[model samples]
Target: MFSERFIQYIKYEKRYSAHTVTAYQSDLDQFMLFLNNPGNADPAPEPEITHPSQISYHHIRNWMVELIDQKMLARSVNRKMATLRKYFKFLLQEGVIETNPASRIQSQKIPKSLPVVVEGDRLTEMLDSDEIFSADFEGRRDKLIIEMLFGTGMRLAELLGVKEQDVNLHDGVVKVLGKRNKERIIPVNTELKNLLKEYIDLKKNQNFDNNSFTLIVTNKGAGAYPAMIYLIVQKYLSNISTQSKRSPHVLRHTFATTLLNKGADLNSIKELLGHANLSATQIYTHNSVERLKSIYKLAHPKA
Candidate 1:
């Protein structure tokens, strides 16, 4: 019964990131697949059969070791561990289980890595790259999508989740579902608001039953999926980004970095990013400090 609904509860109720929910789904899928494996046991069961929830710590440790042998990165392993922990925690809270075996399972320590953000001119170029933004409906939609992500520092899911009613065009604000299903209204600058209005006008001429729900949609009028969002971000920015990962999250990072460099308070940035804690927002401060250190080194006339 653990379907996308449970995932949504984690997203809305627990305030987990879209990325976190996807990872949890993947890890739980893998664990379920492992449990359903009958080759290692007596009298193989049919495919898609459910298994009991009596997993041992040794089994989890073995799974971690297997992931290591498969050359999964430490960050990935740690994420899987976190997923298991969350799943068990949910099970316990729901009274589905008396104890969470994953409670003692320690996540692999991952080194803190600063998020990569596209630099000034590159960011401008990425935003201005109109080769993909033709004088067509789809092109205009893509451009608006990119602008919203880079402008708002919003997660792609939040952008895709935007409803027509949620936007206050008069006030130049857009309300987005932030982490834990919390609502945060972000101010849309004049330029961004103008572009969004244009996109909405174009969308008005399209056929869509769900237009009442989602602000953005595919050419087929379906709400944008997370993968589609990633592809759109990658299709536009990979050419301009110096870093290897040029997904929507990079645009989010760029948004945070730009704000911090311009003197936005950490708490404000946290609210904008919908982060549950200031610690999550502190990463961008590190990026700003590193850039400041570089600028100081380059400008100081120390002998």
Candidate 2:
């Protein structure tokens, strides 16, 4: 009952994305399940502790320990911790609890990793190669998916949320509904503009469904999913990039890095990338500096 109200609160009042709300709900449900029956774990309380007031720092800590024992990554475990923090915070706000138990817990330390990017020139060459993409609807879509992701630097979720009306080819801007249901507009280059027009015309010509009103669609004209987008990115990028991650996000990082390398400011990039803060966009500067080091190592005349 408390969790349902929390779910509704986050879903509506907080305006969190459906995916985020679902994840939060799942976290609460799992925590509740653990509380009710913790298996043979030592954390199990004397009774089936289902009430929110019964929750203590001990149960939360034990849950984190159990999650670690199950091989959950620090980042994922921290996300689960965030869920608990929010849940208890909500409960505390509603007077269901006097104090938030999760407030005492600290987030797990996460390792910092640089974002990977494809070389701008290599990416351009690959995109320009007609031999790589066939002339069919699927081929056009595959190419467009790569182009859209790299061109706009939009997240996969933002790309999937893109509707036909949201893409304004004439205006040279694509509107995306970003995280937390926040909306942002990203400028598109002439090449991307033309590609959008072509894709829209082709979609109309092929007599496919509206694809749930999304710009990117599957072969059957259904809206694209994360796995489908992942496979498409993997198929094309496997040849060009040897980096461990060849996902669609590589294109996003490539977009940000490419802009930074070409002298775009962090603030501008932040706005263009729909980053909530400049800090999130500042990582591209690191990627840019790394590229410069790579170039210096290759071309410098040092002993």
Candidate 3:
């Protein structure tokens, strides 16, 4: 039977991201609802067929074709295919199925799109430190958030997962819970340390008593949600350039690109970003190279 138990399995047992779990649920729920065949345990009208697990590769292919015919974007179609593939893989792993039908299904060929990142000067302009810190609590929190993002280049999820005790005020370091629940410690600079202290002082006056260990809190004193973080980043960075998509990820990309532009090694950047592999972090190098080509086009001679 379709249940929340599967979602709990993915979240607690497999340590999947909330976003990932939501997508998996959507994919599986879609299939389960459509599975009105006789053998299915779901209490739905029969589909005039038996053995729902007998859903074949053709079924998945048809689903893809249907979405495409419905005018879905290529990227959306690809993501849906990926979700179905993951669901089938999960079923295979759990011994509920003999083979993964979705595995044979090919994802649509999406063009190689470059990452949208803030330029180095704009990044510097935003994190100028003096301009960030103000007498207000919101100002202080904003300053700390920007500094942590630009400094460590941590993912938005990792940043939001930061705990109060994880930060070593004296040492000026933060312990981040990265992808796959991997823990990494990144040092914060003096400016960030001071700003964080001020923010904490402001937070204490609010008398928050939530059990969540998150560092950033909402105006209502609850821990920050993923969407709230994205909105905050978008509110600040929307004016810079419409060409560059603004999100917490852009701040992360800006962090890595700045480091690469300043000659930081790729491997080190990978470690800092908590990427599973160097290849994941290598996109920043492409951004850096593009920047170099732009400058060279304008500044170089003998053309």
Return the top candidate by lDDT.
2
lDDT of 1: 0.80
Q: Each prediction's TM-score against the native?
A: 0.83, 0.95, 0.86
Per-residue accuracy of model 1 over 1-303 as CA lDDT, tens digit each: 454556877877777766667777888888776656664333634345342356667667867887888899998898888878877777777776688888898877778899988885677675666565775779888888888998888898789889888888999999998765779989988878988888888888875776655888888788888888889888888677656788888889989998998888999999889998898899888898898899989999881
User: All predictions: root-mean-square deviation over Cα?
Assistant: 4.1, 1.6, 4.0
Give the winner by lDDT: 1 or 2.
Answer: 2
Candidate 1 Cα misplacement greater than 4 A, ranges: 1-23, 36-53, 90-98, 125-132, 207-213
Model 3 ranges with Cα > 4 A deviation: 1-8, 33-52, 70-75, 129-134, 209-213
Give a tens-digit lDDT track for model 3, residues 137-243. 67777767777887778888888888889989998889998876789988877878887888888888767676445789887778888888877777667655565
Stretches of model 2 off by over 4 angstroms after superposition: 43-45, 209-211
Global lDDT of each model? 0.80, 0.88, 0.76
Candidate 2 lDDT (Cα, whole model)?
0.88
- The worst-scoring run of ten residues by lDDT in candidate 3 lies at 37-46
lDDT of 3 at 204: 81
**Candidate with better lDDT, 2 vs 3:** 2
